[model samples]
Target: MNLSRPLLLASNSPRRKELLASLGLTFEVRVKEVSEDFPDTLKREEVAEFLASHKADAYKEDLQEEALITADTIVCLDDKILNKPASAEEAYAMLRALSGQTHEVITGVCVLMKEGKTVFHDSTTVYFKELTDAEINYYIQHYKPFDKAGAYGIQEWIGMIGIEKIEGTYFNVVGLPVQKLYENLVQLKIVV
Candidate 1:
């Protein structure tokens, strides 16, 4: 947790906070409202990075000695991006679409300091077993994953039983790519 500068995490997600803390990094949590909207022309794979960097841009002038970290996660099913669900029906629909299908979970992170900035991303391919209506309903009622992208948490009950395999880092699906982020922190000399 020896950081060269004060570390600031700009996200309200508990998962992101937990993941970052798991790295044994001492940091402060800070969040600012930023628009999640992206241009339609942006490639689906790039949306996460775009949003992450957009969030970091907000504090370009505000940041000084502290290294600001911002992250954005998205669940992509082919050409579609499954964002956080707004309602139970939406959550059910997203989970149903994910049933027995392979999707990509992309998490983009931006680290900004007064010296410079670094933006990167990590992608994980997740395979889900065919989920039943009952299972989906049960999870929705119990977990209420409305705050999570793709209507599910890979660390939750649904993910425990539903995820069959993953081709990349498991933490990416949980909302942060700690391995990659850790490497970036070291490279940036934030972690000494």
Candidate 2:
């Protein structure tokens, strides 16, 4: 499919870039520093969507005529949001909370066309088997998942041995929900 305008991904996440590439779409990356702060009163899913849109808004002036994509993923467990871990101890704690439990991974995506706008979100429920302290410690020390949400990556060692099941898109847990984003792009007339 030949598109009139090029595609721009306004994110620095390698996972999102890989996911987008899997769809066979050629794109360019432009990273911008945007504040992710949101109102604490916003609900979990709302927070994700808001932040994703906020990132997209940062590139409005630089969008030109190309379609821009921005997204944010959050791990929510028991009403708390688990983002990137600040320290090894935090990573261990986040993993412990997810062990032998089901948590929701919601990814909010914003697809901004030159003249059209579309925003949507996808969520996946991940279930982790009980994790021993040794397993958690080993993964933390070996992998250092400080850049991943919930202190883990679905495509990493911890996920291979810890996640027992998932009720939604597996890619969403990694970062971006490609299937959902593709559909939304078509709906917004960004791609056909």
Highest lDDT against the true fold, candidate: 1
TM-score, every prediction: 0.98, 0.96
- Tens digits of per-residue lDDT, candidate 2, 9-66, equal 9988888899898898899999999998999999888988999999998888877789
| Candidate 1 least-lDDT 10 residues | 40-49
Superposed model 1: Cα runs more than 4 Å off: none
lDDT over C-alpha atoms for residue 178 of model 2: 91
Candidate 2, superposed: residue stretches over 4 Å from native? none
What value does the lDDT take at residue 13 in candidate 1? 96
TM-score of 2: 0.96
RMSD of each: 0.8, 1.1
Give the per-residue Cα lDDT of candidate 1 at 82.
96
lDDT of each prediction vs. the true structure? Answer: 0.93, 0.89
User: Which candidate ranks first by TM-score, i.e. highest?
Assistant: 1
